[model samples]
Target: MKLLTNRTRKMDVILIIVGAFIMAVGINLVYEPMDLVTGGFSGLAIIIKYFTKGFIHGGIPIWVSNILLNVPLFLAAFLLKGKKFVGKTLFATAVLSVALYIVPSFDIVYHDLLLASVFGGVIGGIGLGMVFITMASTGGTDMLGMIIHEFIPHYTIAQVIFVIDGAIVLLGAATFGLNKALYSVIAVYITAKVMDGMLEGLKFAKLTYIISDQYEEIAKEIMDKLDRGATGLHATGMYSNDEKKMIFCVVSKKEIIELKNIVGGIDPKAFIIVSDVREVLGEGFIEYKQ
Candidate 1:
């Protein structure tokens, strides 16, 4: 057990290092070159770096601006998520911010708009996705999403993130220009798509509940026809005050449509509820039984 845990820790460290490097390259080479503001602290940095002039510019550099924006987000993470999460996210963000600040001081790179936007989005997306895969976030709107999630459990973290990020982009457009804003949107779109790509195969299992009179037929059909496992849970109808079979099954996203169709055909009036499950460590879904 100790050996396995150590190995996992080592792998996480390696991923963080690589992910941070990719994020830095994207910011310094791609986004910075095109003068495009993205969705996170980096985006805020670009805007602040441009507007503040003379003494203010001299006092607060891009790196400082990034730190300023991230401080609040990091605080939120610490308060909401805990120290470990905040520490990791803050470490990652600091590394990225420092990288973005120092890289330009040493070297110059291509500033072409097309190349910058495409490569920046790709690298940034992959890095961010890697962070998410490790059950951590790089703070910013991600932290805000957690806070919102506490208030609104039904809405997803990603949805809340979108709302916050969209507003930030609009503000950037007003401060910078429409062109910068459009490019930022493109960068955000590409980043989100690539992040999804990175986590594509890590699909979660689904839990389906079907309440219907034809539960036996539906359950049998699901197990026999779809080769899926199911259980007949005892349930009572509140209005009818009568016992019924609640067909309960766990399946992957691929098997869901077939399961739903079978239940629908058997009993069109069936009540179906589906939810995304985090893990299912047993039988057909996982190798190890739990």
Candidate 2:
């Protein structure tokens, strides 16, 4: 038990270091350079930076604003998730925020808005994805999303984040005018797409339910040729009122095409329904068996 606990702690520490590094790249490279405010506390900070630039007499910098905003979110995470998660998340957020401040002090490499926006969204999205992949997150509205999701399991984390960030964008639009705010929207969209691409992959997976007389052939082909697994269930067709065999399996985007080919070859009229699965858990997915 002690050994397992220690291993978990080690993994958490590694996650913190790697997550922090990736977040820094996103903030310094994409978000900051492009001045894109997606949403959340970070979005608020970006808005504050734009209007308040040089307005303060030795007041807190934009980076500090971001750190300060995260403080409450960190506390929320501690209360919501646990002390261990809060500690690691706080360390990572602080490191990334500090790194963002330091990295820019050296120089401004690109002044072109287009270049800055493109690079910033891409790099930042990758960093955000890396942090999320480690069973942890950068504390902010994301923590709030976790809290809300705990109570409302049906409420999506991504949608929760989108709403929070979208609110910030509205506020930014009000303060900064329509043009800059619109650009921020573009950056945010790009950031989201890039993040999803990195987290889920270029070719995402879909959950497919195949109902046909050729279950045995399809199952065998998937197991042997595709090197995948499938679950079979006994079902009765509503229209025909006849007993049917349903095969359920998850496959990547490319595999879906192959699966269609296999099914077509086996049974020209197989009832196949495909649905998008946002995240998958268990062996061959995100988590492995104990």
Candidate 3:
């Protein structure tokens, strides 16, 4: 058991390293060439790179700026989140910093700003998502987000991150032109969405609630045909004072049509409500693991 746990930890470390490297490559190759500012320390580093273009040869290297900017943020994380959180975060940050220095900046000369923004966001988002899955971050705005969340518990980490990134992008507009800043916003949006998809798992499912006269038949068919379990709850119709059974079931996105067909065949006027389920864990779904 101990060996297995150690193996899992090792795997997580490897994943974080790979993810951080990908993120660094995206920044150096795509964001740098296009002069696009994203969010977090990376975006700030770009902004710094632009303002101080003639400071030392071709401005201060992004890796240096990234490390300098992250120092205070890392300290904040250690104070607010604890050593355990900071340990992995620091490792990921170091990986990203080294990668930004070592990775060669590719010259991707292109006229389409939209394409650059999209590719940059996608590549960076995937890297960020992988790092996040291991419960670690590439530091920068991630750490700041955690600190902000500590003080403001009501706000989600993503919301706080957006606010921080948005402010940085605005600063970017001052230096990198308003048009590029606008495109940068698109990059940020795509990055956020992709990261969300990765963190939540792409295998999205649907949670359905059905209220109908033939509830038992529909439930039985769903169980027998779809091989899914349904739970029944007694419901009262306020308008007619009619007692009814509310059938609740979760089905894969692809199975939505089939489930709808079964319900319609049983009762054409069945009241059905379907909503997206991001992640589900149970006997038939993902195992609930600590």
Candidate 4:
């Protein structure tokens, strides 16, 4: 157990570093060059860089702005949320800043706003997803969001983040232009979708709830034919006043059809509800140890 904990910590650190680098690549190579400010301190950094070009060399670097913007937030997080909440995040944010400093800026999209937004969003999403899986965050808007949520307990941190990032995007729009801002919205939406897919496993399965009097035969058929296990959930139908074992089974996408066929064949009048399972783990699924 101790070894596993150490391994997990190491993996988390590695992921934070690699993810932050990839995120930096997206920002410097595509988003920065194209002036597509999606959101976060990175977005603010781009705006600062653009404005300071005349006085400063390449304006203020993204890393500089990132660290600067995040400092007060980190302090606030430490004080408000305590050391435990801030430790992993502080390290992750530092790694992100280092990544932004090391990754070179380039015109990856050749000034194509559409291409820039799409590719940048995808890349950023992938990186964010990786960092998020570790149950840590790369400060910036994330920390700010959490801090803000402290004052308003009614609103969720996610809601506060949406508002903050939205304001930043609007600021970017004002600084850049309407057209670029519009493109940034697209990038933001894409980033969110990709990030969600990352958090939820990419490999999807079907979860079927079989409500039939003949659940035993159906469960057996599923186990034998699909090589999947089915759980019999104790459910009481209020309307019918009937207590029964509702069959609950999860199967791969391909196996879902066969499962349905078996249930349909066994009990034609059976009530079957099928839904998508983002991920399934254990036997015949994702091995958690790996």
Candidate 5:
């Protein structure tokens, strides 16, 4: 087994704490002020708070409700996911719950549902993305998703999560009304998009395949000028039955123009195919982790 270095472990803890705090800010500051309900345990807490406001004095604060709801789920996660997984999840959930209590809530940009939804989504997405980067979850529907995945291995975790969170959003609609429910959907969508962006990285790359006669010159230029590597593959022209070389390379999106110019300078008739690459992990990109 590989052991984690001290710094890596410390960074994991920091990420969990900061992520939870950001999520709390999004919920309390943005969603709560506008009474906008999104999915997951947090949304359920908001619903509980709204209903209990009449009978329960100051009402059930989100932190209390969040803890109350997570208790049993945490127990289940420990039993199912084992100690290591449950430990990180517990850390994140605890931080989030406590943050809900400590973080002061006030409307910074009020009376605008659109702005609230957009900002809340962006903030929450960043928080969730950070937690995910540590390979830990904030333990709400995340736990539920794992549990559901165990039972029905055929259905993807994401599919199960969507169904469960969708149900909660629908319940919010019944409790809050249709308009708020629709707004909640918008928030969820924005949150998902932003989260995906964070996870996949905002800076994209391009993978290009060049079929040209001047493959050696082009490859040399790419390696020398762009500081990028290129691979030459042996190929045959289907029409002419002549041997040829295909150069394959990956470069940043901005570098695509430069790459095209280099290829054009070498061989104007070069057949080049450029495709968007979501991620590239190697010498010039993200380091591959075991």
Candidate 6:
């Protein structure tokens, strides 16, 4: 148990570093240069840089704004949630700040809003996804979302974060103009999709419930041919008032056709319901990982 915990801790640190570095790269190279404010503290940092350019040299550095903006947030989280909850997030946020400071900025997009938006979205999405997979965040609105969820248990953390990020995007529009804001929206959407895909995985499967009188034969055929397992669930038909045997099975998407054919051949009148499963872990599927 101790070994597993230590291993997980080490892995989280590594992922946070990589995630933070990539996110900073997207900000410094594409988003910052193109003035595409997608949201979060990074977006706010860009606005700070813009507004302070007259007084500050090329505006306050993004890393400075990032750290300063997050200090209050981190304090709040630490007080409300405790160190255990804030520990990983604090580390990730600090790493992100350092990454922002050290990462060399070269305008890879050359002020091309379209290219900037897409590339920024993909890079930020993958980076954020990596951080999220470790159950940590780069602070800013991400931590704010978690704090908000403490008050609103009904909403998931991701949903709350989405709302917060959207508001920040609106702020970006106010600073960077609606044209840039619209393009930023595209980047934000892509980021969300890519992030969701990372966390949920790209693999899809089908779950089916089969009701038939010839359960024994159908189950045998499914096991023999499909090389899959099925379970018999006791169900009662309400109007008919009859006990029914429902076969429950989960199979790859490609196997759905053969499964249907097998059941249809044995019991033409068999009732089957197939549903989409986002992720399945176990034997004959993605093995459970630490």
Residue 196 shift from truth in candidate 5, angstroms: 1.9
Which of the predicted structures, 4 or 6, would earn the higher lDDT when compared with the native?
A: 6
Give the candidates in order of TM-score, highest first. 5, 3, 4, 6, 2, 1
Return whichever of 3 and 5 wins on TM-score: 5
- Candidate 5 lDDT over residue span 94-155, tens digit each: 89999999998788666688888788878988888788677677888867877778899987
Q: Report the lDDT tens digits of candidate 3 across residue range 138-205.
A: 88997787688888988766667878999999998888799999999998888887887787765478
CA displacement after TM-score superposition, residue 238 of candidate 6 (Å): 8.6
By summed lDDT, the worst window of 10 consecutive residues in model 2 runs over 104-113
Instruction: Please give the TM-score that candidate 4 achieves against the real structure.
Output: 0.80
Model 1, 1-290: lDDT tens digits are 78877896677666766786677777766775566777776777766776776547443566777777777777667787788777667776776666666666311335456556666778888987777666566666756766677789887555566667777788788987898778778777778777766755455788999999888788889989988888989988899899988888999878889888898888889999999887676767755411
Candidate 6, 69-188: lDDT as tens digits: 998998999898888768999899999999999998889987789998898999998998889888788999878877898899887566676677788889999988999999998888
What candidate 5 gets wrong by more than 4 Å, as runs, is: 1-4, 146-160, 202-204, 279-283
lDDT of each: 0.74, 0.70, 0.86, 0.85, 0.85, 0.89
* lDDT (Cα, 0-100) at 114 in candidate 1: 57
Ranked by lDDT from best down, the candidates are 6, 3, 4, 5, 1, 2
Kindly indicate the candidate among 4 and 5 with the higher TM-score.
5
RMSD of each: 6.6, 4.4, 3.1, 4.0, 2.9, 3.8
Give me candidate 5's TM-score against the actual structure: 0.86
Flag clash pairs in model 6. none
Question: Residue-wise lDDT of candidate 4 within 226-269, one digit each (tens)?
Answer: 88999999999999888988999888888889998999999999
TM-score versus the correct structure, for each prediction: 0.66, 0.71, 0.82, 0.80, 0.86, 0.80
Winner by lDDT: 6
**Candidate 1 residue spans exceeding 4 A from truth:** 56-59, 105-111, 153-156, 204-290
